[model samples]
Target: MFRKLIEDASTWHWWREWMLIFLGCIMMGTAFVFFINPYKFVPGGVYGLGIVLHNIFPSIQVGTFGYMLDVPLMIVALLVFGGQFGARTVAAALFTPGYMNLLTRAVYPNEAAVESLDPALLLNGQLNLSDDLLLTAIMGAVIIGVGQGIVVRQQATTGGTDIVAMLLQKFAGIKFSTGILLADGAVVLAGLLVIGFGLGTGEAGEKGWVLTLYSLITIFTTSRVIAYVLDGASYDKLLFINSDHHDELRRFIIEDLDRSATYIKARGMYTGNEREMIFLVISRKEVRQVQHKIKEIDPRAFLVVTDAYDTFGEGFKPFPSADVMQAE
Candidate 1:
């Protein structure tokens, strides 16, 4: 068993997975160092909590707090999710904080050393772009989303809230995405209370509501980006057809579109006529071709096309196995 484990760990695929995780950690760390942390925006997850805590305790680094939190969470993951998730989650959890600390040091060595929230401006205010909350929100979302998407695609995550979300998914029978939303929602609310209300005293006079709205925007953007990266963009179209020339349309779909179709026998209630209904799913790019073929076959053919958010099968995304762990 030990030898086999060693062999599996030495494989190219294993190294590739670790490398992708490292890259993801770097991107996430960069997002925190340059955008999320400095701008005081909470994008959710454990790091969001870290951000709020860092504000209260200016002496502690956000990444350090993240590291402290991740240790226990990774332990919980080991017990709940087994070894695969445990090992990778450990790597990701460690790497994220280390990279965040390293990047902060490299960019703002003096500020990082001081343990303060005095705005680590790049090049003596030359590159300090933390003023615009909207820009920071969007940029941080995209960067963190892509980083997270990459890690999630590799069947791992940066740990923290991801572990909690996964545990909820396992025990509560909730959707992974919904679990993430719930976990992140709580973190964002906490951030609002801390930053906006100044630790519930409302004495800080901060724009807590506005910050909450920004956090919502960040969550929406990140979710959309993650979906695009994982299941692909909303480029799938589902077609439902009621046509007289079923044979021609079937042939066109099979031969021309290089796609398959399912046919069902149906009856029109008003006309009391038996009909053949066809159902097909194709990429959005193929819409024009399908329309052209349908028009040629029967101009008056009844067709309805709607967006397909996630289509998993032979032509689309394959189902994730147990190895493909989702992150919050």
Candidate 2:
């Protein structure tokens, strides 16, 4: 029994998901401590709110606020999503904030360290600052986005706004994307008022609307990066094949490509001849195989390939489940 347990723990499949989750959380925590939190850059999430609150209450660490906020959200997730919410997600939600706190202490040990990095820190509750806001926004966004994307891909989350988004979707019938936009948008706008505008009271106040604009840039960059990382690049290709050898091409697609196709009948504009056209969505990598096979079957086959996004269904991403409301 002991050896069986040990063997199970040693399996790559058993450990891979947890390892990735831990790494993803660490990456996200590093982004927040070293980049986002230090700048008061609100990229929109619970952590964004934590940044605003931390500015108001300097004694409290942002990650502590994150932990406080996440607990209730995790409860919401458990109640709404049931067992599908899973212990791993709960672990992620709890660990990320604590990890962020650890990183913050490690990276920015003292006021002197903060000031040495960016004098902007003097104004923002002794935060470690960056010289270039644009660079910080871009780099932070990429790291955080990729980290969050990896966690999400592993069927877990760091909780926070993800739970709220799921709640909105569950009760209000709002779509996850729209719910996320509303929730994150509200946080970012609130950050603009609380941190960016600052009521002419602090360093961020002096930075003014520019800080809000930078936050917007960060949010946009983060969203793009998350989408790119979560959705494989291969899924972007949509192939249109007009082939005389429909049977042969279809057989190749079914047997070799192991993909499905939709057929539509249309008449040629100039020739006034009716023809059957095959439409299929495939990964970019499979385009070459399809092309070669079509050439072998029908040299004169007309082929058109276009970029596509949000491809969901068989052989691709399924619709997001309530439990899988991914977080940033």
Whose lDDT is greatest here?
1
Tens-place lDDT digits, model 2, residues 1-328: 9999888877977589889988999999888777787677887888988888877767778888888888887877777666655576798988999898766666664745433423354335354345677888888888988888788777777888766766786688775445666788888888888877674236456774787788888877776666566664545588888878888988888988888889999889999999999989988788888788888889999999998766778888787664454432
Question: For candidate 1, lDDT tens digit of each residue in 1-328?
Answer: 9999888877977889889988988888888887778766787888888988887887788899899888888889888777887788889999899888777766764865435544545444554665688887898889888888788787777887777767887788765666677788988888888888888434453577787788888877887777666656668999999888977887888888888988888899999998789989999999988898888889999989999877888988787775454432
Error of 1 at 257 (Å): 2.2
Report the error of model 2 at residue 190, Å. 1.3
RMSD of each: 3.5, 4.8
Error of 2 at 299 (Å): 8.3
Best by TM-score: 1
TM-score of 1: 0.89
- Native-to-model Cα distance after best TM-score fit, residue 244 in candidate 2, in Å: 4.8
